[model samples]
Target: MLFRVDVAAAEPLADQIAAQVRGGILRGDLAPGERLPAARELADVLDVNLHTVLRAYAKLRDEELIELRRGRGAVIRADADAARLRLVELARQFVGEARRQGLADAEMLAIVREAQP
Candidate 1:
């Protein structure tokens, strides 16, 4: 997976890393069982602290999106894609419900916008 970091962005480095990695998984850019670069190497590549990358990896692990193994580095979880797929399925159901309720696309989008963290 490709990673890019913006030093000037308001988000923390670890969060940025996690977000990008999650996005890659959702977009099918990262396949299950793919090994991520070592934290130290990724830190050097992104010019961030080693702990920053570790934190990101930990977050992914917590979400069951990746697995961190000794002598094996970080690897995407086999069932990781299921989460995104489920989200897509739920979205389709939600859109259908919204349509049935006579909600316009723009109205549904507005509701989604308001639900963002």
Candidate 2:
């Protein structure tokens, strides 16, 4: 998967890396069982610290979007598709509920923003 980092962005490098990988999986650019680049290699490519890449990998693994195994590297989880589909379904339901409640898109999004940590 192609990864890029905005060095000048406000977001942390690790978070940026994790977000890109997550986006790739959700958008079908990265397939289930596809192995990601080794942390060191990705860190080199992105010109970031090795630990930053590893931290990003850990976040993905913790979210169950990917799996990390000894001698196996990091691979996208087989169930990621199901998880992504469920999230999409949930979002659709949320939008429907918001519409039924007469909430405008901006208002609904504002509520979401307020609820976010």
Candidate 3:
């Protein structure tokens, strides 16, 4: 697969990787069930860290755009509806996990409240 990384971009490397893969998925450049290059491979190509690739994969997985499996690596998810549902479930889990880490509902509420224009 032909992929290039822009180290000069303002966004985080993980976010940049996620945006490209997500756009490719939406534009049909990468089809459902297609296998993405392994994180290590992509990292080497991008001259970034393996953990950066993993972070990108994790973001795409959170977006329901990809499925990461042991040994099998990451693959695009085919079912759009299922992906949406999966994102919802992941959001719930993330919020729950954050709460467990001492980020209470009130603190979250305060952040949201402060974000308004």
TM-scores of the models, in the given order? 0.71, 0.71, 0.66
Give the deviation of candidate 2 from the true structure as CA RMSD. Answer: 7.6
- The true-versus-predicted C-alpha distance at residue 8 of model 2, in Å, is 0.8
In angstroms, how far off is 48's CA in candidate 2?
0.4
Q: Number of clashing pairs, model 2?
A: 0
lDDT of 3 at 108: 75
Best by lDDT: 1
Off-target runs (Cα >4 Å) in candidate 2 are: 82-117
lDDT of 2: 0.86
Candidate 3 colliding pairs? none
Candidates' lDDT values, in order?
A: 0.89, 0.86, 0.79
Error of 3 at 59 (Å): 0.6
* Model 3, span 31-71: residue lDDT tens: 88899999999898789999999999998898777899999
Q: Candidate 1 — worst ten consecutive residues by lDDT sum? A: 81-90
> Model 3 misses residue 114 by how many Å?
22
For candidate 3, the per-residue lDDT at 112 reads 58
